[model samples]
Target: MSWELVSGLETHVELSTNTKIFCGCTTKFGGEPNTNCCPICIGLPGTLPKLNRQVVHYAIMAGLATHCTINNVSKMDRKNYVYPDLPKAYQISQYDKPLCEHGYIQLDNGRKIGITRIHIEEDAGKLVHEHGDTFVDYNRGGVPLIEIVSEPDIRSIAEAREYVEKLQMIMKHIGVSDCKMQEGSLRCDVNISVRPEGSNEFGTRTEIKNMNSFTNMEKAMAYEYDRQIDLLESGGKVTQETLRWNPDEGITTPMRGKEDAHDYRYFREPDLVTIYTTDEEIEAIRQELPELPDARIARYESDFGLPEADAQLLVKYRKIAEYFEAAGEGLANKKTVANFILGQIFRTLVTDEEKENGAVAIPPEYLHDLAKLLEDGKIKMNLAKTTLDKMLETGKPCTDFISEQDMGDIDEDTLRTICQSVVDNNPKAVADFKGGKDKAVKALIGQVMKQTRGKADGRKAEAMMVDMMNDME
Candidate 1:
């Protein structure tokens, strides 16, 4: 019997607030291990938790963006658990009264995956183990988080990955979270099971915890789906447990038995008051939300005439999309702008400094000018690439670089002279073109472009060279 995979995601997003959810401690990542913590975050005696107002606002914004219904009133609860990373012994989270409910995200194939709920919670601290000793850092203990739980509607590994990616893009566009997987700002826990094809009954499910990367998430799901199917086929029972993905080995190892909700012994917290919101406030937030990925992609296609693939690529990252819009503001050929950024500009941003800072060194105006020049036929694509490299290296304007380096497109006279020189230098190529070897002219055009340092338009030069060689024949 064939088996079908069913998966859902529990994604945790760290809010981009300046301070922790219930304390005044800094929520910045990568500080001295224990320095960013405070009494309330570390759960010191006589300390009480106070909720951050911005966290609630961001949660509401997230809910609105995902089409979730915002709860008028929500309260916090204590999730009783014992772990070294959780210094408070019990974490303050939302149980039955989460902030948002009943939402869905649509996939590219037009399939809609239901969102169960989005709840606000505090993050646990980090436990670093080295040299046979474990060290606990409370710096992240009280960071605000929103847990987006999806229904078990995902049918394949590709759907699962796309769902998470779409969510990341939405959150980043709204400016609620950075969603950086490497920094632990965005993490996913996948719950997957395999049942017989066309069966209504679900198979035993296992949870894969803390898949930080999309590549790993897909790999782990593939591995786990196979593991469950193999067990069921071998006449063995599939166990319910939490598993850890070993990326290097490409396998899922059992971590521990999965715990149900009752295992956490949840109860309403007494110290903090219940949260409240109004329709006016929700409307205000909805007005402040930026255009989401799907809407932006549609606009790009309809308004700018960008292809679906190109529009999707631009809107995948909020910053890149903004850059494209700003630079291509009034240009007729927005596709040219998109191609230059995706092809030439992206290639120069491979350094560690650029990646960490999340910026392109070249200014947006310079990019706009480069695209305009290419569209106007004032510069060849090859010469534009060269000018772009120099602009990126020096952070100078494209116009200044092009002027100082004399990178203008070669005039028709100069281009014809270079094409003639190339044709005279290559007798065999000239003979081949005359003998109806159509591809031989490409070699001659390349020679002209080389002689002019990529400043000559290859199409014009190809035509000129073919004409010159035809006259000789």
Candidate 2:
């Protein structure tokens, strides 16, 4: 029997603030293993956890950015559990009293995914397992986290990926979280199950953890869906358990039985005071939100007259979108700016896979100036690429770098003279062009570019070559 995949996600994005959520420990990743821990974060005696006001502000900002109803009052609850990672044996998390609720994000296909709730929580410490012993690092124990829970509205792997991507972009654009999955800052837990199409009741779901990257999230969901379907077809029942994704094996292995809500034994923390927000605060955060990716993508298309694909490309990153907007200023042809941003500037920085992760440190204004130079035709497209590579190397503007290196575009009169010299040299190619061999004309163009040291405009050279060759014919 065929089965329909059903999935939901719980994403915990570490807030970008420097300090932990409940204490003042440094939240910076990759310190000397456990040096960043402190009394309150590690649950020492005579130390009490104090809420980070910035974390609350960011959580509300995230709520507003995603079109959620902000709860004016929220408080923390202690979630009791026994784990090697959590030092307190109970994570201070929000249960029924989340900061935000009743939110939704629209998918590209026009389907809206309902966000059940968003709560503020503290991250647990990490466990490092060695051959003979295990170590605990409480550096991340009290780090700020926003747990975004989505309804089981996703039906396909592509939909799940899109939702996660949109959420990540929104959070990044709002300046709340860095959402860097590699640093364990941003993590996702995928709950997946499959049932026959048009089934009223949902099937048992398995929770997959440690899906640190977006690609792994998609792969894990797909694998779990198939695994559940195969089991049901063979008269095997799905088990409710916590599964670990072995990215190397591309499969989810059952780790242990899932913990229910009562397993945590949550209760309000009497040590900390209740949190309250006023309308003024919500309005303040709402007004401070920058233009999100979806809104910016629409503006890029409708207002700037860019193609849908180009708009999507430019608006994917907040930095790139701002650069494009600034470069388009006072320019008659916004389309030209769009082309330069998408084709030249972004292409230069995102060359290798590592660069795609923001490795290359080329400044935005440098790219803006590079686009401006290309717009003015002070440099040809080929020379622009060379200038870009150099700028990427030295972080200099294309104009200054080109002037310093004397890599200007070849002059038009000099290019025509070179074209003539090319026609004079390649006699066989000229004969072939006159005999109607269209491919033979490219040979003359190559000769002109070669004679000019590839500084000539290729199209102009082709035109000059065509005209000179036609005169001989």
Candidate 3:
């Protein structure tokens, strides 16, 4: 039987607060292990957790951005669990009284993924294990996190990936979280179940973990779907368990059984007071939200006349979008700006497949200047590309490199002179061109391009060659 994949995601986005949720410890990354911990965060005796008011404000902002109904009163509950990484032995999180509910994000296919709830919680510390020894760091403990739980509205790997991306974009645009996957500021756990194509009931769902990037998220979910489908087809039963995605191995390994709400043994925190927010406050946050990505993408397509594909690609990074708008300002060169961004700038700044850092480091303003220079015809296309590569290396603007090397486009007179020389040097090509051969004219243009060291615009040279060859006729 052909099966369909059903998936949902529970993403934990660490709020970009300056301090830990309950303590005064810093929430900055890459400090000495356990240095950011305090009695309140490390769960020491005689310590009590105090809720961070900023965390609630951020949570409400997130809810408003995603079109969720913000709760007027939300309480914190003790999520009882035991793990080496969790120093508190129980995480202070929201259970039944989450801060927001009933949100949705529209995918590219125009289907909305329903958000079940968005709740605030504290992050657990990390475990470092090597050579049969293990250590724990409480630095990450008490870092504020907003866990966004989505319903099983996702039906494919593609949909799952889009939902995650949309959610991340929402968080970033609203300034709720940095959503940096490498720094563990944002993390996701995917739940997948496969059932017959037309069945209404769901199959046993397996949860996948350890997905660090969007590509890995899509790939791991696809691989797991195939794995589960193969097992079910061969008469093997699907188990409800937690599986870890080993991106290196490109496979999912069974970790443990899945846990339900009761497994955590949640209870209201007696020490912390319940917080209440007003509708007017939530409305104020709603008004403060910046233009969202979807709306921006639409405006980019309509206002800038950018193709849908190019607009979508450019809007993925807010830095690039801002750069595009700035470069396009007051210049009557919108198309040229779009072309440079979608064409040259993208090529030079995105080398994820070849580079170790997985991203290019060219400054945004430099890209803007490069596009402007190209629009003014100040440099040949080949030279612009070369200048861009060098700009990526040196992080300098195009004008600096061009002035240092005197590498602007060759003058029209100099181009014609080089074309004449090429035509005079290639007698056979000239003779063939006079004999009504257009291909030989291209040959003469190639010679001019080679003689100029690829600095001449081949189109300009080709036009000059036709004129030069006709003069000999």
Candidate 4:
């Protein structure tokens, strides 16, 4: 019997607010344990928790970006729990009344994963286990976070990855959070269940706690799917439990029984007041939103005549998209700009972090200058591309490497004379071209470029060379 997978993700995104959600403590990462803490963060007696206004604004912006409806009135609730990391025995969060509700993030395949709610909350501290002792760091405690709950719309591992990646991109684009998983800024709680194929009813679900990276998400989901299928096949029912993914052993161990809403013993937070936002305020925030990734990708394809894949690659990273536009300014063929970014620039920025941060040595205007030279026929692609590499290395302009003679193309008559001389000099290649070897013409063009000291346009020369070969008897 074939088993199908149904999955939903509860993604916790740490907002980039300067202070803790309910206090004025700094929200900086990697501080000494308990050093960044204040009385409010450590839940000292007689301290009142005050809400951060910026947290509410950033949450609304996130809600708007993900196509969610912003609730006009919302209130925070206290979720009671006993853990050393949560200095406050009760964490302040939103339950029934969240800041944003009923949102959906659309994937490339036209599937909209429903988001249940995006609520403002405060994060617990880090529990580091070393040498059989658990040390608590209150630095992250009371840090602002917005939990995005998604409905069980994911069916496959690929869709799960896309959903998470889309969410990550959206959050980063809105400038809400860094979404750096390594730093615990963005983490996912994956809820997975497996049922018989073509069945409408969902099987018993098990929750996996806090998957940080995409590779781990994919591997963990795949393993959990197989594990559940095996259990069902053996006539054993799966348990409803919370589990942890062990990357080293490639298995999920039971953490504890799954907790429902009632498990938390929720109540209204007495310290914080109700949050009320008006429609005018929501619209003002919506206006602050820059062009999102999907719209930009569509525009790149329609306006620049770029391929869909090319557009997606450039638009995935915020900095790369901005750099592409700035570099493409006033250029007739924007696709040339895309090619350079997707080709040469991407070749250097190999890692996702480097690409996401736009860690290129040269400025966007430097790229614009290089693209202008190519469009104006001042230099061929071969020379422009090589010069781009040099620019990337030295943060210098193309003029530093391209001389005046190398700037302009050889004259038409001179180019043709050079082409004929090359054809005569390389009869074997000409014969190879006559015999239907299409790549042989490249050798002829290579000679033309070499003879002109990279001054000749490789593309134009290729076209002219191919034509001359076709006309040969």
Say which prediction, candidate 2 or candidate 3, comes out ahead on TM-score. Answer: 2
Q: Which stretches of candidate 4 lie over 4 Å from their true place?
A: 257-262, 420-441, 459-473
lDDT of 3 at 209: 75
State how far residue 434 of model 1 sits from its true place (Å): 2.9
Superior by TM-score: candidate 1 or candidate 2:
1
Please report the TM-score between candidate 2 and the true structure: 0.88
The residue-by-residue lDDT of candidate 2 on 1-473, one tens digit each, is 67888888898999999899877888898888789988888888788889999999999998988889999989999989888888878889998889999998899999988899999999998888899888998888899999999999889999988998899889988889878888877898998888899897899998998789888888888788888988898899998888999999998998864444237778998788889999998998898889888998898788878898888877667766766777677665678767755665566565523333444346566766766676776666666776677777677776666663244677788887888888898899989989999899888876765565456788888888888888884
Order by TM-score, highest first: 4, 1, 2, 3
- Cα lDDT tens digits for candidate 4, 1-473: 88899999999999999999989999998977889999999999999999999999999999999999999999999999888988878889998899999999999889999999999999999999999999998899999999999999999999999998888888898899999999989999999999988999999999999999988899999999999999999989998888899999999999864453237889898888889999999999999998888888999999999999999898889999999999999999999989988988898898999999998778889999999988998888888888999999899987788888888768888988888889888989999999989999988888998898778877778888888878889
> Model 1 misses residue 300 by how many Å?
1.7
TM-score for each prediction? 0.91, 0.88, 0.83, 0.93
- Evaluated against the true structure, the overall lDDT of model 4 is 0.91
Clashes in model 3: which pairs? none
C-alpha lDDT of residue 223 in model 3: 92
lDDT of each: 0.89, 0.82, 0.82, 0.91
Model 3 lDDT per residue over 256-317, tens place: 65453238888998888888888888888888888888998899888878888888776777
Which 10-residue window of candidate 2 scores lowest in summed lDDT? 352-361
Off by over 4 Å in 2: 248-250, 257-262, 344-370, 373-394, 400-421, 446-464, 471-473
RMSD (Å) of each candidate, 1 decimal? 2.9, 3.4, 4.2, 2.5
> Per-residue lDDT tens digits of candidate 1, residues 250-339?
999988644532388899999999998999999999999999899999999999898999899778777788888888988998988888
